[model samples]
Target: MLDINNILIFFSIYMNKTCKKLISCYNIFFTEQGVRHEFR
Candidate 1:
């Protein structure tokens, strides 16, 4: 059970990083268009 918890935590962190990267790329694309949008 402890190992499973650790795996879940790792997956969550990995997903968070991937999501942040995607959002950053999206923000760059939107900024190029001169429109302001936020994610939070």
Candidate 2:
């Protein structure tokens, strides 16, 4: 049904946004660790 398709599209878009956020956060975590090591 058209309604089901719409839901899938919305879900995919939200998931894409969330995925990007998670990846950016993960990178930041590693960067923070590297910076901490340098300071130590």
Candidate 3:
């Protein structure tokens, strides 16, 4: 079985990567919305 500390470290790294991805996606989405709003 995996050690508890190892599992926690792995989970934190995974979450950090996913959080970066989510932030990037949100930035792109908001930029698109802003452009659309300016055109209207």
Candidate 4:
């Protein structure tokens, strides 16, 4: 059986990568225009 700790670690890593990708996307959007408030 899979270990619960390992599963949690994997999920956290995935979330971290997703967050980084989102930040990069936000930077790109910012350079295109400063109207990021619409995204919020």
Candidate 2 regions with alpha-carbon error over 4 angstroms: none
Higher-TM-score candidate among 1 and 3? 3
Candidate 2: tens digits of C-alpha lDDT, residues 1-40: 9999999999999999999999999999999999999999
Instruction: By lDDT, rank the candidates, best first.
Output: 2, 3, 1, 4
Tell me model 3's lDDT, rounded to 2 decimals: 0.98
Q: Indicate the residue-level lDDT of 25 in model 2.
A: 100
| Per-residue C-alpha lDDT of model 1 across residues 1-40, encoded as one tens digit per residue | 9999999999999999999999999999978666544432
Clash-forming residue pairs, model 1: none
Regions of candidate 3 where Cα sits further than 4 Å from its true position: none
What is the number of residue pairs that collide in model 3?
A: 0
Q: Give lDDT tens digits, candidate 4, residues 8-37.
A: 999999999999999999999887676666
Model 3 weakest lDDT span, ten residues long: 1-10
Write candidate 3's Cα lDDT for 7-30 as tens digits: 999999999999999999999999
Clashing pairs in 3: none
lDDT of 1 at 21: 100
Candidates, ranked, TM-score: 2, 3, 1, 4
* Each prediction's TM-score versus the true structure: 0.80, 0.81, 0.81, 0.72
